[model samples]
Target: MRIGETAAAAGMTTKTLRFYEDRGLLPATDRAPNGYRDYPHETVSRLEFIRRGRTAGLTLAQIGEILAVRDIGHAPCIHVKDLLAKQLHDLDARIAELTALRATVAEFHEAAAAGDPAACDPERICSYL
Candidate 1:
């Protein structure tokens, strides 16, 4: 199929298809006489895999590694597990930070609700901010 048809079949934009090609995540099987890209029937499945990997918070480079493993006829389960572990750790850190921020915001809200104009501390910056 042509690039446009492949992209449409994959539920992605043509630009995304081109970008994946450039990143080596997807490669054209051949080129037409008019310079259009020709893709295999399995390209749709590959694109779906890439989309799923991205949805799982994998970066393009990480997805590329998974694709490389697949290309070499290896199952990517172990590598994917490792990547998910790291993503979980990063998410935990972010959750901690957000929890702290929520606590601080709640404290400030309580202080303001207590009718303390000092909570608006104009000498520095807006306390509500």
Candidate 2:
């Protein structure tokens, strides 16, 4: 299929397909007579996999490494397992930080709600914050 057709089939923009090609994530199987990129049917599934990886918060480089291992006829099971473990740990840490931030913000909101504008201290930054 041509680039536009393939992108439509994959539910992505043509520019995204071109960007993936430039990033070495998508490889074109052939070219049309007019020299436009022609993608194989497999490219659509590959694009979906890439989209899922991005949604899972994996970087393009990380996805590329996993793909490289798979392309080399390896199962990539160990690499994928290890990568997921690290990603999970990082996510847990970020979630903790976000939870703490939420608590802080709630406290600030309460303080701000109770604060009197007439009592604002000029010597310090906004006490509500």
Candidate 3:
């Protein structure tokens, strides 16, 4: 298959396919005598896997790690599990931080709402901050 056919089969744009190839996510393609890329039909499956990995919130580098393991003829399930756990842990920490920030913002908003504009000190900017 050529690049266009592969991209269509994989439901991605040609540019996206090129980007994946440039990022080392896709395997190198063979060049025809005319210098056009010739991809194997199996490249479609790999493209699908890349899309699925991105949908799961995995970074390209992380997906690359899994691909590397599989390329080496090993099952990457354990490594994928660990990566998922770390992602979940990081998400939880970010949620906690965002929750705290939301609370702080809400308090500031309430203070600003209750504050009298006339009572604001001239030397300072927004007193609510």
lDDT per model vs. reference: 0.83, 0.81, 0.84
Worst 10 residues of 3 by lDDT: 67-76
Which regions of candidate 2 deviate over 4 angstroms?
Answer: 75-129
Measured on C-alpha atoms, candidate 3 has an lDDT of 0.84
- Give one digit per residue, the lDDT tens place, for model 1 in 47-71: 9999987886678987887677668
lDDT of 2: 0.81
Using lDDT, give the best candidate's number: 3
Ranking by lDDT: 3, 1, 2
Tell me the number of clashing residue pairs for each predicted model.
0, 0, 0
Candidate 1 clash pair list: none
lDDT of 2 by residue, 1-129 (tens): 888898998899999998988898876468878898888888988989898888867789878866665566755587667876776687789779889999999999998889787786788896567
How does model 1 fare in lDDT?
Answer: 0.83
